[model samples]
Target chain A: MNKPPTIVIIDYGCGNLFSIQRALTELDVPSTISRNPDEIAKADKIILPGVGAFGKGMENIRRFGLLEVLGAFVASGRPVLGICLGMQLLMRASHEFGYHEGLHWIPGQVTKLRPGQPGEETVKIPHVGWSPVNFNSNNDGLFHRLQNGTYMYFLHSYFVTTENPMCGIATTTYGNNVFCSACCKENIVGVQFHPEISGPSGLRLLQNFVFLK
Target chain B: MKNRRIIARLDIKGPNLVKGIQFDGNRALGLSEDFAYLYYQEGADEMIFYDTVASLYRRNNLIEFVTAVSKHIFVPLTVSGGIRNVEDVQKILRAGADKVAINTAAIANTSLIKISAEAFGSQCVLAGIEAKRKENGDYEAWVDYGREPTGVNVVEWAQRVVDFGAGEILLTSIDREGTGNGYDLELTARVAQSVPVPVIASGGAGRKSHVLDVIHEGRADAVAVASMFHYYYAKPLQRMYSSTNADGLRLGAQIDEGNLEFLNARYGGILERRFDPISVKGLKSFLAGSGIQCRNM
Candidate 1:
């Protein structure tokens, strides 16, 4: 059998890099953290883990000169997963602190999660906790190995609403709003929840991502 | 709009977890990591590590413990106590904590809440408020782990934090803590009503009904439990392990080392009935059965 491919974690200087490394180490998957474009270019897979606002995250990414490098990475078609803010940065734009442009890989907009919407109940902002997700059992995606309504840890004040409905692999309901929890289109996958902090089911999801070609 | 959270709060005194009543009479439990690992397996929604004396001692000592548990436990862990500034919050986050709950520092400098939120995001900042009920039937905000009164109204303080940049609130009732009398519903309700963020009700959780009351009546978004969940969990593990960790330090080294044994001998029979050691899975089912809305594992 071929040796398991090594994964490269990009240090954008915003996410929980240590926890992500710990999770991967526990999984026995060899990985390395690098800011060098050359190192990121040579990796088989990339995980963009970020935690913070859309505006600040974009500023840091631009400063590190990773904007163009990351664009080529997604274009290469190797598996790429964006977590939380990392996922939000994949969208077309975000309405966070102010108007901010995203990587635009995923055709969507990032908006603050408020209590009242047209048909939505007044759920609190910054929805924090563990909630069950709605996954299509037949899709065989990152969450395919798990149950249909498996619970995953979620903590966010903003959510991704994709223009193409088919891109959302799994959905979750908060109050009257049924927003996308996990987004997948080809090799690119994004999740609003943190799998690193999510537990066994979360590990299974990461394993599924790891096994992807 | 979101699933109500069932959070397990562990108050630590150095390595071993200590239990106390209203912040007094603290008795040591075993290794903090062991209990944390168990709670995660049992399906806790989230966990809070509140160091009872880290501020008094002028040091944050949970870095090693947080790093140990973050390896396998994949759930949101909120670290409170001795969070003096933004740098302290950053170091704690780097140590594997998902969120930092600020009380003393936030009260001392309200801008700490806003600046931290701007730096990290609303979801990453949690304002922990310790409140005590006054004779006039009003809630007053207390600081220094409820040892000092801030002369600030509980509801007003909660609103101030939200306006300043707190994404969530962890409200603990000083008088009701560890009394098994139930949460201070009125106080929780007032704070929850005033804030746009999620409010976690802490202190005085005796039964599942107490949780329900606070959620529905108090409008709390989450319920935090300690004795109700930790009491039955640690006693058995204490007997099973002699040494607390790889270190040579023997288990049960605290001044009140025999509290667990004494409680077991004197009130073990009714302890389960009083606090009701409901397993994580069982508690979810009980909540669903009671027609209360909660996420199932």
Candidate 2:
């Protein structure tokens, strides 16, 4: 068996890093949390995890000078998984609290997950809880090692709507709306759910990400 | 469409799991970590680690328990009690709690909700509202585990909490809690209807139908229970289930009188057979039987 390459979790100062790190450790895949450009760029795979606002997340990434290395790293065709806000930050823009620019790595616009009339604040926003993720194609990359209809926990109000519709490879429903839950554009992938906190299915998803060539 | 959530709300007193009727009597159930794992395994949608008396004691002590459980349990965990400021929220979240349920402190300092929500996203802050019905047929919000009354109408407070940036409302009725009288469906409906965010109907749930009442009629996004989860088959207040079959869970593989001690030493107490004593698994299957969508099944 070949030794697993060094997996780096990009610590941009905000994320559920501990849980993710603990999950990786349980999978017997020792990983490192790094903000250094060189360490991040040199890793075998990268996991961009964030837990807060898209603008603030982007601000931190730019502040840490990780914005460029991240794009360059994914351009190298190595696997990169963005979780929740991390995935949102991969989009071109977000409508949260005015307008904010994303990494533009994935061609999409981040918007609130709602289904009522426009400006009706009555609809539930942050769609919290566990829901199933249905893939557009057969059990392939990202859905690797997992069966269909497996449930993963989600904790966010906003979702990504890709301009490049082909970018969305997976989908989940909230209310009457079906939006992009996971997007895979070549080596770049983003999931608007927390795999680290999604239990065994999530751990399996992380494991699949680890072995993804 | 999203499925309704079934949350196992475990009360903690200094890192130990305890259960009480209407926030009064404190009886030990088991170690926090053990029951957390057990409940999560038996099909709880989520878990709440509420420090039952964090105010009287002055600080939160379940950080280590949250850390231990989060490492193993993949579902979201909400920590309540003694969280007064953003730093406390940060502390709990850093310790691996996914959300912080603020009650007393949120009443003391309303800005804590906005600040914590801004810092850690609104999704991480749950407005823990303990409400008691008043003489005027209106409900007032209480804090410090129903010790202090805010004199705020439950419906009004629920809306205010959301506007103040609470991602969800954990509405617990003091009147029905631990009584097995079933949740205060009226109270739950009022608050849930008033709030834009998700509302978790809690307290007064003795049977599975009570959960249905709150979720279907009250429009609560989730249901939280304590006593329903503490006992099994109307057992006595001392027997604790440790195995998947609800066998007495061992403390250290210790056997006493040919039976494994179910987490003995002031731990593991069952509630009286007030209502139907069913396991989390039973609750899930019951809900599923009624065509309700639940995880792990």
Candidate number achieving the greatest TM-score relative to the actual structure:
1
Q: Kindly list the per-residue Cα lDDT of model 1 for residues B1-297, writing each as its tens digit.
A: 457888999998877777677877776655677778889888888899998988787678888888778778778899999888889888888788888999988888889999988887777789999999999999998887778898988898899999988889999999988777899999999999888888999999888789889888998899999887776675455344434332311244442456545443423344645677667777778888877666565
By summed lDDT, the worst window of 10 consecutive residues in model 2 chain A runs over A115-124
* Chain A TM-score, structure 1: 0.94
Candidate maximizing DockQ: 1
**TM-score of model number 1:** 0.92
Q: What is the lDDT of residue B82 in candidate 1?
A: 89
Backbone-clash count (model 1): 4
TM-score (0 to 1) for chain A, all models? 0.94, 0.94
What stretches of model 2 exceed 4 Å from their correct place? Answer: A117-123, B233-247, B250-272
**lDDT tens digits by residue: candidate 1, A1-213:** 567777888898788777777878888888898889998988889999888788988998899999988889889999999998888888999999889999999999999865776664688767777778887434675865788877777877789998998888788887766788989878899988888877788888888888888
Taking the candidates in order, what DockQ does each have? 0.72, 0.63
Candidate 1 segments exceeding 4 Å error: A117-120, B235-273
